[model samples]
Target: LPSQVSDAYEKILSRSKDQSWTRIILQIILAATRPLTLDEANVALALAIRKNEPESHSKLKLELWLGKNFKSTVMNLCGLFVSVYDSKLSFIHQTAREFLTDSEPEGTWKGSFNMAQSHHPLLQSCIFYLSFPDIDVFHPPFDLIDDIDGRIKSYGSTEYPFLVYAAKNWPLHFVSQNAADANAFRIQARTLCSATGHQRDVWAPYYFEEYPNSTFDDWKVWPDLTLASYLGLYEAVEDILSKEKPNVNLATEIGRTPLASAITQGHESVVKLLLDNGANMKEQENDGRPPLSLAVWIGQEAVVEVLLKEGANIDAQDRYGWTALSLAARSGQEAAVELLLNNGADIEAKDRFGMTPLSLAACSGQEAVVKLLLKKGADIEAQDFEGQTPLSLAAGYGKWANLWTMLRGFVAIVKLLLEEGAAMETQDHSGQTPLSLATEKGHTAIIELLLNKGKESKLSLSQSISA
Candidate 1:
């Protein structure tokens, strides 16, 4: 089936008048996160060429080029191999897409449809479109629809149809491509990072409106290396560090370093690069989380390993005294927990609230983490500052009506703890036993398990008394 589709694709490419342009257009369609509008695709293609041309000159050339080739329309170019429904482009069938994207296509298509190769041009075009001077006009004040003509004049009397797509999707395509060999992408990314005015004032806020921990205001002050690392542009980061030894530990307004940014995004290569180049691993962010804790919390086991090997303090605690192990356990990072345990992390390390790793795991209903902790000799009945045992916390942590599945998980943890010989009648500071807590939360299954265990304990007591 794929062979037949590949044959058709070959014939289509052969019949196309301009094969290289057709290939680039096809790549834009395949690499686009969503179905691109016709105008967006056209702008993307135009930007792919003449990237170094000034916006005004580029606009004139783009219009002339489009006018000359407009009759070669996308539908007519690829014929039956492509489809246009509602003005969005896609392949004729899902199988056609499959044929093109197959890891090991035969004949001429082998290694021709590389993902990095496909995304490189799109990302390049996006950066080119964004670098236009007219981007600043899209910031505010004027309504997008009503002020179209004014903006077009600023864009050399041409509509910048792909501005929004380019602004928002550049990061998506940036990460999709291999950054190791991309000196061009590295330069563009670094240039964007170094932009103090437009990137900060316009595109950063527009692109990262919903991104967590990103303050648009901070973009003005953050070091270029920090921003580049956060964006996960490995080659770009390498470029910045290579030029000279800048202070890698320099914090942004929010007190995050390049290392912290790379760690948060799980960019292993970048993290390692930062570490090898003297990024301080012990420097906590304003939130008080050390690099090791941040890596463990996010379940970046590879990054975690790198940090540990780099001499990151395994038991380093945050401001709240939550050690890396505690964060890993609470977040259900089983592999991280195991790795920390194997690395001699204090399994019984306590947070400021005296909640151990086992306590947090049980309270968070991490069944696998809970089991692993127990096997590693975690105190099953360890009490927190509030005197809540692991069993007590698990039994009543999320007993509310909406968390039915959480209650079930708590029930399982209760049974596991009980089988591991956790005391059934253990009480908290408020004197609530695991059974009483279960009863209060209306956790019927847990209440039953506690009751059965209680009955068995009492029976064993009576038999010993009789003997």
Candidate 2:
């Protein structure tokens, strides 16, 4: 044994100096045994009784022996002394039993145990019980999943393994580990697609192959393309499309077509190739949403440009009567809104709710789009069906950045509205004035800007207050 062990033994022996030398030697020998068997425990108890040793001292010595040799000894003891011993000893025995019964060859086990002190009352535990110090039981290569019947089972199921206890959890582990393994990568990609209905793009790169003539219509070939596209494998997508005439128009069960998926994620190059290779630019999904709407909604300006160049209908509306320009404005895509407007999109187009694109731009605090629409001769005083103007909508959102952007040209528009006999005090059905809405939203700068432009209207109020 090391010096520390020898010193500890010497210290224990010194504490019992009043005892006979023979009894001390016997106690030390019993404590040094590799595993405390049942017979050994009996012998130890008998010796302590014969020597008239204190019960507490005898138990402490037994605990010290068990602490050092519990792994080897407890398994052989068949959970005998646990109920007879103190709570600490019982806990050690219980944990040892769990490890022996649940741990796999990989030395990691994922299962739950019932304990009085646990928060869940019944808590799941992943225990790494190992003899080698170099082995990390916490992060095993594969997690051992125990059956509902409490039997330890190998990872042979079609479902992916979950380290219900590992620090990095299962999904992240699967993602990181398989990210470089070709076969594992493909499996993970397919599994993710199946689980999430292939709506996400993270698995695209793993599914698509880097070869010509690889048609994704084949289930096997499709998995490859799905992985390639989801993983952002640009070269893989190009190579696959080059070799195989994959069905670029293939839509998932949820109606997420490959082009829509790529464009929504800002994969400009993949989108370009898909468009160039006859991917339907106007393919409306089951939801009646075209790919251009997704590009505009996600603020992918480059993808929007590519789609527009491919002659995608600039005025196509979704089921909600939302055009790409409406989506761009609502999502704060200034450039996309400009592109759509310049492409002859109707600036005053209203959605299903009768809210115009300008109203949406104003509500979202998109000052640039508001200015662009105004310059394009969009009616500044145009009201939604509820009689809410763009300025009123802008005041409601209280976006200072958007308010500032709008203010750069707002004076001229306010003047035009006033000259056009637009009601300066016009209220929505809520009876809220534009100034009241701006103040309620804390748009102090917008309130100031509006006050300066509406000084004539406020003059009578100012004179009344002075009187």
Candidate 3:
């Protein structure tokens, strides 16, 4: 039911070399987590060669994925063994897929296609491909997405295929178990790291976009021992730590220690290993954001519990004066907020901007954090550096903010503030009331609610005047 089983098809694939390439084509189809595009397959087969000499690379680039006869060559070699769908390599039928992966003959499948071992070849191909002298010039301006995409696309056709594929997939190949590929990958990683800022910038964007989820490891900006720990590379972490009198607290350029990176990655083993080997749990990174703060910043509760148990400074603030509770509350991390509150974090603690955790929680529309902080006696009318209260903060008045940005839960926070008897007529140093801020932000719901509260407060004031 798959392909027409013609004798001509059988005759062509029966050739010994054709059969070998056929096996590789099938393997590429079977083991791939995503579709293996025609161009990707062509590049893969080209690099399947094992030579590492500079002369070998020069020759390979000439015969790369864009080789003149590349299309017909792959077609003749594949025969009916594989199919092309949407320009991606694949088998024709479900039966073909099963036959390849079932291992019915028990280990007779193509040696090159074994999912466990195939990654090494891909990894080698990537490192070799990226090693091109030209890659040294492909630098994105910053870590921003548009800059990255634009810079990665700057390579010309011959270079673009290898450039995109290598940039996109190398991390998977790197993490694949065949990591000890003659120590080549380690040297490649070191080489990339050792390159000028321009070269490293080209590769780092892909790592950020795909590798691990968005975490604070900061591998894109700085791939250090800390990043290795975060990626759960035990050998790499141990290798870094085993050096003579290693500074266990060494932070990345972003101020993240190995422990902070591991925590962000949620690798408990790496976290424990760092701590057992002397990672300072209290060490803060980029903005005085301590390891404990980093834990809650990403909402890793397991790491949070560990840091708390290890005696992390519960109230430690970043350079902006944000504490663990402040970050969790702002990000709507209820579990972390609860954990910090239970551990005696200062619920009403103010940052340098005089914005308390409650203030941030309300502004971020995190109702639970707002409620939790209020339950813990957060100063409802506390003023920030802008002389704006938590209610004003809920109305979205940050010290550096010029515009009244509408936030979620504005109505809920407004109601809660009114219920708590927070002064409705209170104004910031700019003389704008909470109602004025809400009106400016065009938050009609919150504006209506606050107007009614204003009328009630006026009525109470008139009654007191008569009394």
In candidate 3, position 354 carries an lDDT of 86
RMSD of 3: 7.5
Candidates 1 and 2: which is better by TM-score? 1
lDDT, candidates in the order shown: 0.77, 0.51, 0.67
- Residue 52 error for model 2, in Å? 75
Q: For candidate 2, which ten residues in a row score worst on lDDT?
A: 121-130
Q: Candidate 2, residues 192-274: lDDT per residue as tens digits?
A: 43323432222222122122133222323344454455444454566667866678787766566778767766777778777
- The TM-score measured for candidate 3 stands at 0.64
Clashing pairs in 3: 255-285, 284-290
**Ranked by lDDT, top first:** 1, 3, 2
Error of 1 at 255 (Å): 1.1
lDDT for model 2 comes to 0.51
Candidate 1: regions farther than 4 A off: 49-72, 141-159, 179-181, 197-202, 212-214, 399-408, 463-467
**Per-residue lDDT of 1-467 in model 3, one digit per residue for the tens?**
22343333344446536566566555555545566667777776676555662343456667765643666677777656567777777666565555444443333342224565656666666767766655554544544644444555555234556567676666556666364663556645545543244445666555564433343125555445665665665555655667534677877666767687788877766687788898887677766778888888887889888878877899988888898899998999988888899999988788888888888887777877788778888888888888888787676443323233334556677788778888878889999888788767676667777888888878998999999
Number of the predicted model whose TM-score against the real structure is largest: 1
